[model samples]
Target: MKIVQSTWVRYHHIDLARELHEMGHLERIFTSLPWWKADKESREQHVPRGLITCNFLMEGVRRMGGKLPFYSKGTDAKLAVIHTKNYSKWIARNLPDCDAYIGISGSGLHAGKVAKSRGAGYIMDRGSSQIRHADRILREEHLKWNLPWNPVHPWLIENEEAEANEASLITVPSHFVKQTFIHQGTAPEKIRVVPYGVSLQEFHPVQTPPDNCFRLVFVGQFSLRKGVPYLLEAFKAFNHPNKELVVVGNVSDEIRPLINSIGTEHVKFVGIVPRAEVKRYLSTAHALVLPSIEEGLALVQAQAMACGCPVIATPNTGSETLFSNEKEGLIVEARNPKALAAAFTRIADDLDLRNEMSMACLERVKMLGGWRRYAEGMVAVAREAKALVLSTQ
Candidate 1:
């Protein structure tokens, strides 16, 4: 079961790649690095302004980082899988001979086209559906964050139709995502919901209130799609005297102005940090808030919960499958700063409730099964795809 895993974004790819490696199935990973880090190390030596002006540049940096190592390693694999539609296309020309292909998201089905051309069986990896979930977030944020009309809405609809019809197996992390595909015309038989698992060893809970300040953490891109602005707005109304919002990940230029306006006194931007450092931040936080407009099942949600930090997120975050409002964590309506603020206020005022949620968060991570289960499930899908290819041969 040799596997080539293509990671376009970050955590998801890292999670799957590491899990596969530990399971002895991972053969290679393709991805990129932070642009600023790249520029600092490259022969060019000049600082890249992308970090200061463009989210695409930031992502490009990560893609290039992911790609550089793979480029140097001679290509060899029995099976190649990609996490995104774009990566599938990029790997089509370079992919090694294999029995099957895997696409972790709907867009990734495009990789199946690449595999089909090479006489390989294609399997949909259903990571997240940007078409269905992303749009809802866009609509929610338009009102919540006072965003303008979305120009990308039409394109999202078109892609949803194309992707649903292309995949052989649609893999999802939650029923919410699977339903999104069904709504887009994919049959339920075609969709397989596999929960994205967390690494309990690395993400387990730690001593809270490590510092004097009550840290409310939000990890991920500071974009409307992430429901970042809404989180900021809600945090603004929090009125906590000794609290701080530690925002991790790179900031996009389009939203930087808004992030800055959110008030620097209470908000601290740590910028991009390595995957290893994320757990440390999660450990110190009082709570995790993901006011995302859309997501599959963000690994961060589970990571935070596993770290014993109760999560406060929206229904659309996909991790809501695990959250049992007032139980493991609180669920707020998407795009409502008022609701988000209210949830935070309650947690801020009640120490006992926060402690209970923290304990519940830890318990839920174990009951849901961790990364070991996730790896086994993904391997089964690969085996299925491989079998289908062999049967045809």
Candidate 2:
């Protein structure tokens, strides 16, 4: 089977395609230009260096004066797309000759709808539940941040409804996500649960601490959606003398003042480090804390757990699948600083518990299966879809 994948989500689809191709499938990926290079100068200067590769059709459209469909003539050729709400409609206009297109999440589903009218087999890879789950997180954040409760954001509600109605197959990352979708009016059969995998090579256990402070690292974008405020408040309330919170990510401009006001002497913000450097922080940290109120299956939690560091996350975030409260790692209620503070105290005060949790986390890593497993599962799904198409013909 030949598959073409598209998205602007910064996933290394080339690596995934390579793995699938090695397993006897012809795979081609199509992603948008690097988000950073929206201007003409950046694209011209960087394309030569191969900093980002343009999608076959997008490049042709820019070079030539017309939009042409991708034409590598082969009976087995198939096309898969990552649907984002921003430019999904462009997929149909861009790829007039493709077999199938897929949306990676509900947002993707909204994008895929545009392709559906063009006769593409649409699949929804439910990477995250944008409504039922997002609402839960919104409620939590509202209480913690004292913001207005607007669970049903008008734009998101429209996207969620469109995704449920249009996509033929909806893929979910966890049972929690799958269940949430079902409860939100999606049929159970439409939702397929596929858990995410970790890259063990990039993130593994470390031996020694880098400093005297018991490092508690949180890595990702600094936004309310990630429960950043909750994390800061929890860390502040954690009554540990030797511990420090190392926040590694860019803070949203809106929340900067609020974050700055709460964090004290022991807390330090290291904004947006390189991906390679993230592992170094994870290695040195005693534990990883992700108090995100809204998320699907976060890659950070998986990376941290693979590094043999215990994790403490709220149930609203999909990391709850990996960590059990007082088992593999602590699981706290979303947006509750008091609960998070208590969990932090438990891990910090009890050295034996921390050690035991770390060991369990390693075992959990293997049980959840790694990147290889995730790749194989993807192949199985795609092949099934391919076979169904072939049988009909």
Candidate 3:
């Protein structure tokens, strides 16, 4: 089957494209950022500079001391509406005819519609929880933290719902995400849960834990949605003499003050490092904590596990698919600092348990396989969707 995929940014779609190409099914990939611009190694043929110009303009505005609409809540909502609408229209016009078209959710509406018109199976790939559920969770989080809640743009939700309605199969990364879609009234039969995979070649076990201190790491954007405040509170409450919290991501302005207010003596903010560096941190760390309130399957969990670093994550992160609770690492409840603190203490206090968990994590990753397995699963789903379409016709 000939397959074409489109995404606004160079996400895991590039990996998907490469896999499809290897399987002799990829026709072309449509992306906002060009492969050359994104990575020196990528040689895939893609529609370049689709929404890259808008991204550059937003960056320029930020550099010029203009609070670009991309940053503010209300302003960002407006920008999202404009960006997705333009990107969807572009995909509709530019996407090539193929047996199947795989498009990322928000930006897939127009392209899916166009693909369906051309008698191609349309697959909408949702990388997070249902749009409305995500928005509600974020809004509640902001309210709980007394921060400004900027709900997702209405147009984006509308577009996603439209895509869901039109898609032959809606692909989600995790059962957590599938549940969200089901809760939001999407048919369970229409949703396919294909969890993401880690790059074992890039993120592998390398570092041994130091005898003196236990190191804990958190990777991803520092926001309420990641349950950062809960993590911070738990880290603070845990009474480990040789414990360190290494945060590796961009700190949002709204969360900066809170981060500052909680003393940063033991917490190291290693802002936004490359993937290689991230692997290094993951390898050396004793445990990776992701107390996320909402997410698809967080790829970092698998990456950390691959690096022999057990994860302390909430079920919302779809971590159950990665490792068994208390085997690879503990699965704690989200938004509960006490549970997080207990999990932290459990790992930090017991040397043998920590070491055993690390070993389990390494073995778990091997069972999960890598990106190639993920690609194969996605292709299987696409073929099934295509077959169904053909049968109906």
Candidate 4:
């Protein structure tokens, strides 16, 4: 039951690696994090240094690009393409003997080919929609809003498509992402839906259900992609005398002017708070709102759920798949401020419904457990892929 995994950064992959190591199934987990940072980050699980393989070259390149005076979106995009190619080649040349290889999408196309030739099932874990689907949708959105838009770099898009084609199995964070791949002509059978889980240690229900002043929370980057402008508009229209909206996370430059235009009367933009503070806001708030136009699975929704905070989000955020609509919270249409405002008012008007939803959120998170369950789900997918590949061989 040996398995190899690759992730360019510590976006939940490190957690998976830690769980696999605990279960004695990790052959190696390749990452772009520097050796020291990797050890420090995964210290909680005590994932041995032996279980990690780092390509500091990738990290160095990223740092160098950031420091360059000419740094811009174009520069970042080029660096991404370069890193993907280099990382994939390095992994392909040094891949170890394992029954399965799971690589985060973009950096595994070449290594996946090598793994497949060795009778190892190649699994590509994509955290978001298919590249083409995402690019098209975002472009359309930006244009509709009359905002400047840059199409995704062709090299990155083509490379991701190649990785998807090369993998024997593909895992996405939510069914919304799965539908994107299916829409792109991929067979539905090859796509697996695996919604992410939050760390229960960092996020847990406080002793009280939401009451008193009506406070609305929105976590995550405040960007056009997240539909922040719409959220601001919704917040403006919602009628409440003692209401306050807490906007956590950094405000993206793209939406700064729109945010200013909306006027933050009762809105508090506490940009980039600590994790504990985020949990505090979630635990105490009446409801959390995520009106994202594009998303994989907005882990904040689940993190808020873990705090027993009812969430009001749109299907595009994969919120529909996590809990029942109007039960756990509300799933409204994206890019619609009226809908968002209506949902906000609905939750605020009924205290009993809010309390019930809060209890439901705690129970739901209990059933989901935490990263352990998500890690186990990935393991199941890997086992299925390994068995299918070995039988064919």
Every candidate's lDDT:
0.68, 0.64, 0.82, 0.86
Residue by residue across 1-393, what tens digits does model 2's lDDT show? 444455454443443544554555433344565444323323332222222224334333333432245542121111222223334555444543344555454335533554445444556665666466577756776676765553454454666567667765666667667768877778887666667777777788655444566778888887788887778888888887788888898877657777778765687789999777887887778888888766778778888878778899877668656667787788888878898888888888788998898888888888877756766776666556444444544
lDDT of 1 by residue, 1-393 (tens): 765554444545556655676677765444444544334423232222221111233345444554665642112111111223344455555555555555444334455677656665566565665465556656666665565634443443555456556655566787667777777667888767778888787777555665566789989888877887778888888887788989899886667777777766688899999877898899889889998767778779989988999899887778667668899889889888999999888998888999999889888888878876887887787777666655666
| RMSD value for candidate 3 | 3.1
Please write out the lDDT profile of model 3 over residues 1-393, one tens digit for every residue.
888887766678877776777778888776666434554425342323331222233223333443544455566567667767777787788777788889888878888878777778889999989999999999998898788777787878888998899899999988889999999999999999888877787888777767789899999998888999999988999998888999999988888887777667689998999767888899889899999999989889999999989899999999876679999999999899999999999998888999899889888888886777888888888888777777777
Show model 1 residue runs off by greater than 4 Å. Answer: 1-5, 9-11, 21-90, 97-99, 106-111, 114-121, 132-161, 210-213, 260-264, 383-393
RMSD of each: 8.8, 8.9, 3.1, 1.7
- How many pairs of residues collide in model 1? 16
Instruction: Enumerate residue pairs that collide in model 4.
Output: none
Supply the global lDDT for candidate 4: 0.86
Q: How does model 3 fare in lDDT? A: 0.82
- Candidate 2's TM-score reads 0.77
Give the winner by lDDT: 4
Residue 209's C-alpha lDDT in candidate 1? 65
TM-score of each: 0.75, 0.77, 0.92, 0.95
Question: Which of 1 and 3 is the better model by TM-score?
Answer: 3
Tens digits of per-residue lDDT, candidate 4, 1-393, equal 898999987887988888888888899989998888888866766788878889988668778877788778787778778888899999999899998999998878998888878888889999877889989988987887778887889998989988888888999998888998999998999999987878888898664533567998889998888888788889999999888999899988776777788788999888998767778888878888999888888889988999999999999898877888978899999889999999989898888999899989988887876888888888899988887777878
